[model samples]
Target: MEDEIITDGKYRYIEIGEGKPIIILHGLMGGLSNFQGVTHFFPTKGYQVLVPELPIYDMPMLKTTVKNFAKFLEEFIAHKGLKDVILLGNSLGGHIGLLHTKLFPEKIKALVITGSSGLYESAMGDGYPKRGDYEFIKKKAQDVFYDPKVATKEIVDEVFATVNDRMKLVKTLAIAKSAIRHNMAKDLPNMQTPTCIIWGKQDNVTPPNVAEEFHELLPDSELFWIDKCGHAPMMEHPEQFNQILDAWLVKRGF
Candidate 1:
């Protein structure tokens, strides 16, 4: 079945199936569509999966900030009348999730972060690439995948499309700078929520070392490393990702 789109004035999302709420937040170059691979399966497993298209995805004119996104999530939960939300975030989305958890721990039941940013400073350069630079965008995309072919021209084109506008490029750069400057390592030890930290063993972006740091710091968290996977195990190795997620859920007695 097709997922239904929902909106509460400021945000737009897709709601699927029924039962517990599991919100999936996408990375810097993602939208609700980014979760296509796993969105359908969750509902069948008795979950109300919500994939939101954040403002940063569509409105590049809006300056993206961790604090702002946290506020947005606060309003989003209240608008949906959701409680005990399980947040599954990747990359920038993961950063936002961490910020939200720090600000409003009472709203979350658990957190699942994959190849997440914010635990350590980003290695990406100071500013966004020039608009319409396909080669640059393609190279960056390839860096995230263990297999270069998975980067695909179409994917690169999509990124190019988003960053083609100068205004969007500015916003993207602002967010990138903010990402590198933001650090939540000190706050992790204080987080009381149950957490699962998943990372690609071969991740060049955040690296496995950062994942280990997270596992060490989060008092109530576990880390699962996927070998041979790059920055995006969910996309590069969906089967393994699903298996690990299932096991985590089982352990939680969900």
Candidate 2:
């Protein structure tokens, strides 16, 4: 069965211009609105952008898992009749994109991952302090930003406004914990799709070293580094991010 499309609902998105399809997934604690400016930027550059909010939220009925998240994206593609989709994601969303590519490699035309997670330096013996379970959940939200000022109460409040269930935070933290423990890097080498990995040179959350490892494992992938940015470069440096993305698409003729 193809994916069903629902409109006039809370799940926000815009279909603009018209060319090859490009779907974007947001990181943890983000809604589709996290990409407000992006929809226009891509469409005018000559592509379609589908920015869908993940189905799971505060609803006790909703189950958000890597497996199910991929299923939702599959449905989304089918419902919209999108072909030649260039899938992209950041952080936890990037992990989801990798999983989706593994599941439906043929549906994806290409992949772009930014400061993605799932590679932690646990076994490296870097002598870094290991975060306890409680500490991980309560991990310094401030540290994810290149500038700690971005962690201001207003920004935190805006993010929390979209997070329906506070308990979901526990689940997300645990999911991230498992990614580093279980490892998602194994799926990339088998991937034949054109892949690009973008990183913030100053990213502290995932660290620049994680990008190096991803580049090492995914030998067929392209890596780009952006300076004067942090974890959420898309939001922090929208122009530069969009420019590079546009260039990547141009190379592919999307």
- Best TM-score among the predictions, by candidate number: 1
Please give, for residues 1-254, the per-residue lDDT of candidate 2 as tens digits.
Answer: 22233463445455556887888888775555555566668888778777777754432423446666777788778778777889888877787788888898778988888877666522111322233332322234445567666555655564454333456555655454545654667876777778788888988777889888888777568788888777776766677888888887788666
TM-score of 1: 0.92
**lDDT, candidate 1, 1-254, per-residue tens:** 44668876877889888999998988887656656667777788888898887677354444477767777888888889999899999988888999899999998999999988887745464454666667887887788878888777767887788778776667777777677767888898999888988899989888889899988888999999898888877787777887888789879976
Report how far residue 120 has shifted in candidate 1, in Å.
Answer: 2.1
Candidate 2 global TM-score: 0.80
Which 10 consecutive positions of candidate 2 have the poorest summed lDDT?
A: 121-130
lDDT of each: 0.81, 0.68
lDDT of model 1, residue 136: 81
